[model samples]
Every structure is written in structure tokens, then in C-alpha cells.
Target: YVTPVKHEGVELNILPPGEDLEQIVEELWNTGRPGPEFRELLEKSGAYNFYDFIIIDSAPFFDVRYTVLSIYAATRYVVVLRPSIVDSRRTARMLRRLMKYAKDFGLSTPDYMARFLGVINLAKSGTIEADALLNLKFTGVKPSKGFNPFKHPSDERRKNLEKSIEGLRKVINFSNYVLPLNADISRLEFKEIIKGGKSDNDLKNTTENLLKDIWLHATCQK
Candidate 1:
């Protein structure tokens, strides 16, 4: 029984830890291999019928059985990261491991491998630190305006903000991804923003443009 936070356009099904389900997953991982029952349970979760897309936010580490299970069930993956060299490198390594698992299960063909999505968050424009993201080879997105967690930096501190954004932009550019600069909303305003009105339209437009290329890549297989 997956307790997903059900929504119209998105369903957030979290893989919880330290629960009864966790124990079962851990036992499966101890075997060092996936079996028929594992695939059956994952398929019977009914995600495909319930949602147009299912985004699995797995654990950061790969040792956990739940994380591997989530990756096995995924048709597409979206990797969200801040623009940093460490984050980029870590994600790259993670993808490598996930692909290795997929290949073991006969799921690592070109079509299956093409479903990975990358995204850079809290990105700033015109910075060298941001360039580190360019080293990665994948399609991704960045916020149009950088997220300033400092909450209205004083004039004296404004320079620091500029520097932060500059660094992230480098990562965004390096990844060759699109920038959804004005599309970000605060956590508090997210529900209301997407409920309707100009914010909703803006979000739709931004998402459409950002995903157009990805859609083509996903469906245009010859």
C-alpha cells in the first residue's frame, strides 16, 4: 500500500524508511538480486494507471534496497541538484550505478537509458562556479532567477549573492540545459500558484518549453 500525496498533475509517492515495508525491502536487498516477486509487487502498485508520470524521490545512497527498487520501477528519472561540482559529480556516479543495475536486469537498452532527466536548482547567472554543471552530459533545467535563501541581503551583502549566482550559472551552462528563470515559487505559495491564474499559466508555459526537447527525445526514436 503506497500512501502517495495524490494531486491532479503530480503524485508524490515517498519510499519511507524504518517501517514494515522497509523491512521487506531490506530483506530483498540482502539477497543481492531482484526476483519475480519484486517485479510483480512493483508493477501491481498501479502507478501507471493512476498517474501520467511518477517521480520517485529515492534515497541519496545506493546501498538501500528501497532505492534500488525505486530505480527498477522508474520509467523516467529527474535528478534535481544545486549548481555545484560536488553535486554534479555525485549525480554522475549515481547514474552509472543505476544503469549498471538496469543492465543486469536487461533494462539498460538505449530506449530505457534515455529517460533520465537532470535539473539544477538555486542557480545564478554569469558565474564560474555554475560552469561546473557544464561538465555533465544530460538535459536539465535551471531557475530563471537564482534563489536567495539569505532573505533580502543588505547592500553590503549583495555582492555575495551575485557571486553565488555566477557560480551556479556556470554549472547550468555546462549541462547545456534550459533556464526556467521566473518559474520558481516559494514553498508557501506553490499550491496557490498552481491552483490557477497567471502564475499557473506561467508555470505551464515554462514547463512546456523546458520539456519540448525532452518530449522529442523520448518519443522520436527511429
Candidate 2:
């Protein structure tokens, strides 16, 4: 699900998965003009509510339409990358295509150019210095740390989850959002996947850190 946060006086709209962009845009324009009605829809849909931060979580790679739509709609773009060669290549290619599409659609310019945030790295390990450097060349966001000690259903699962989170966290950090990998997220067993299950301290610390990061980032933007 895509989560949006609004803080300060800046307005942010996060479009997550399962949302129809065309429909949303249509609804926003239904009121004749893109003004209060669009803003009202955003609030009514729980996408915004006077806050100054918005985060939209898009679906996986297989679901490309939503991802493209989300990126197009976003005022800032945050691309998540991994240390692995394959993942980095894929992300780079995706960015290239996205930029090309934006240009083709007349959405690329100085005003919109700054909106293309940067790249983020997730669960990086092994010899990825070269890969990371290349990513930076593409104007991606590189964080100073990685979220280690990920928890999963099993040892193997944990490892896999760690890999994914490493990539995801890097991307998130690049976006200037310091959302840590919570051990408690693994404890949330939902018959299929677990969200988190870390000790209270770990969970609390993670949440606090994330909030602090958000506040600092927002303040800096202002």
C-alpha cells in the first residue's frame, strides 16, 4: 500500500499500489478545475490530512504501470537500487526509460528536473563499491549506512528479506527518509508473510529514528 504524509505547509500526495491513476486524475478534474476538490479527494482517501509529508509505496517490478504512474505523479522521484550488478543495471535502465518517457511527454524541465530525487541503496554487501559509484553518477542518493540484522520467517527467509530490505532501505534513505529495518516487522506473521516481530525497544527505537529523520528532512527542505 502507498502511504502519504503531509507536514508543514508543503503538500505531498503518495500513490501506492492498487490505485488507479487515471481514475484518480479523472476524479480530481471532475470538479471542473484542479483545486479544492482534488485536495478534498486526497484527504477523503486518507492520502493527505493537513500533514506536510506523503509517501506512496508502489508495487513490485512486475507491476510496471502503477510504478510509472506513481513516478509521473510524484513531485519527487526516489529510485531504490541494490549493490548487486544485476539490480543496479535494472534500476539504471528503469531510470533511463523513465526520464525518456517524461521528456517525451513534456514533463522534463528545470522545475520538474529537481523533482527527480535520487537513488537509494538497500541491504548492500560484497564488493559493491564500483556499482555504488556508478549509481551515484546517475544522480542517485547514497546513504551512509545500511539496515542490517533483518528478521524473517526462517533463516533463509531472513537472508532473502535482508537482501530486499537492504535495497529498499538504501532507496528509502536516498529519498531522505530514514526508515529503519525493524526486527518486529518479521514477527508479524500473516499466514504468508511477516511484517515485524522485534523487541519493544527495537521497534520503538526504529520508529523514533524514522520520525526524527522525517522531521529533519522536512525542516531542511523549508
Candidate 3:
């Protein structure tokens, strides 16, 4: 039902508008035979065991429905977000609420946070504050939700957390994965991003390390 289109060296599987596959997916979702979400179609696509990963980069026009579908389809997700202290805190709180809502409505399973790999900050290069937020280690914290360590270390427990983080600042450079804002990459399509990033040796090395971390994150999950 789907064909893989080759763009440059990357192969893309697209579901364009008015396609029969799209119509079939819609029919299956409505009839509730296989499932009510797009994720079921993805599982039965015969592509899972063939590829190490399949990224569904789609605009969430249906917001909650699409978000839940993507979350369900993918084993894990990596968030690309800007590094801001307040926004870090807000992101954690918002995700907890989303998980609860998704669970209550049967849209998704619980423990949604477990599938989160990590965040890649889009902050400007040489930004100390952003680096600190990105570099903070995620271990030992009781409630280490996504970006939780980046939130203000206001309380006594959080202060201990900050102390632990400060000790690791020099040792573990997790912020090495941060992809600073670049005009070339901004708003670029998937194929373009892949093509443009191939020439940069520094980017290639860092991306390789990031992929290793992502695989470890997936394998280490319970």
C-alpha cells in the first residue's frame, strides 16, 4: 500500500493526499476492525523488523489524536526543544497531564515518560545557561521527569539535585548533543536535513554519539 521514494541517498515513505492507502487507513479507523488509530497500520506495515527505526514526522493537525498515535507507534521519542528554565518546568508538568489524559481516554498506556529518550536543545551555541540545562545528569533524582533537573533548584531536595548536577558538569558532557540554531537547518525538510548535515564532520560525530545514546536508552528500558 506504500512505496518508498528515494530522495538523495535517503528513502522516504510518504502518504500523499487522496491516496488509496490513506482512504484505507481512514476506513479501518472508522470501522474499528484492526484498530482506531494510525499506529496499528504502522505495526502491520511489514517495516518494523526491517528497519532499526522509522520516524513519523507529521504535523499534528488533529492534536491529541495524532500525538497519541505517534506516541503509540514509536517505541521512544526524542524531543527537540529550546532551552529555557521556565519552559523546562512547564514541559514536565504538561507531559504528566498529557499522560494522564491519554490513559484516562484509552488513547495511550501509562508510564508515557519511560519512552522519552531525551531532549536536543535548539539553543544558540556558547550559551552557558542552555548548556547547563542540557548537561545536568538525570540520575539519582527521585522524580526525574523530562527536563526535571533543569527546573529551578528551589527546594532542599532540588538543591541536593543541583549539587549532584554541579559535580557532573565537568565529567559528563551530555550537552554535546545540542544542535545550535543554524540557518541552513532551520525549517528544512527531512531529506534536506540529512543531505546538509552529511558534510559537517563535527555534526556527523556528535550525531553518531547521539544515536548510540538513543539505542542505549531504548535497550535499557524495562
For TM-score, the strongest prediction is 1
> Candidate 2 residues 120-213, lDDT tens each?
3343222233223323332222233442223222334334433543553443344432223333345543222212333444334434443454
Clashes, model 2? 31
Residue-level error in angstroms, candidate 1, position 29: 1.0
- After superposition, the stretches of candidate 1 with alpha carbons farther than 4 Å from their true spots are 1-18, 35-37, 44-53, 62-64, 105-109, 130-184, 187-208, 211-222
Candidate 2 Cα errors over 4 Å, as ranges = 1-51, 101-111, 124-222
Ranking by TM-score: 1, 3, 2
Candidate 1 per-residue lDDT, tens place, 1-222, comes to: 446676768657764454586678767767766544566665797756876655556765645555567666765555566655566566656655665565655654544555655555655443433332322322233322453344543433344434443444343222245343344544424445445464656454444544554554434421
Write one digit per residue (lDDT tens) for candidate 3, span 1-222: 356799778777764535474565456557653232455566576667767667665333334444555566666665444455454544454455446534533444434455554444455544444335344532111222333344564445435433543433322223336554555445554344444553455444544555566667656533
Q: List the residue pairs that clash in candidate 3.
A: none
Looking at model 2, residue 178 earns an lDDT score of 24
List lDDT for all candidates, in order: 0.51, 0.44, 0.49
Which consecutive 10 residues in model 3 have the weakest lDDT in total? 138-147
> What is the TM-score (0 to 1) of candidate 1?
0.56
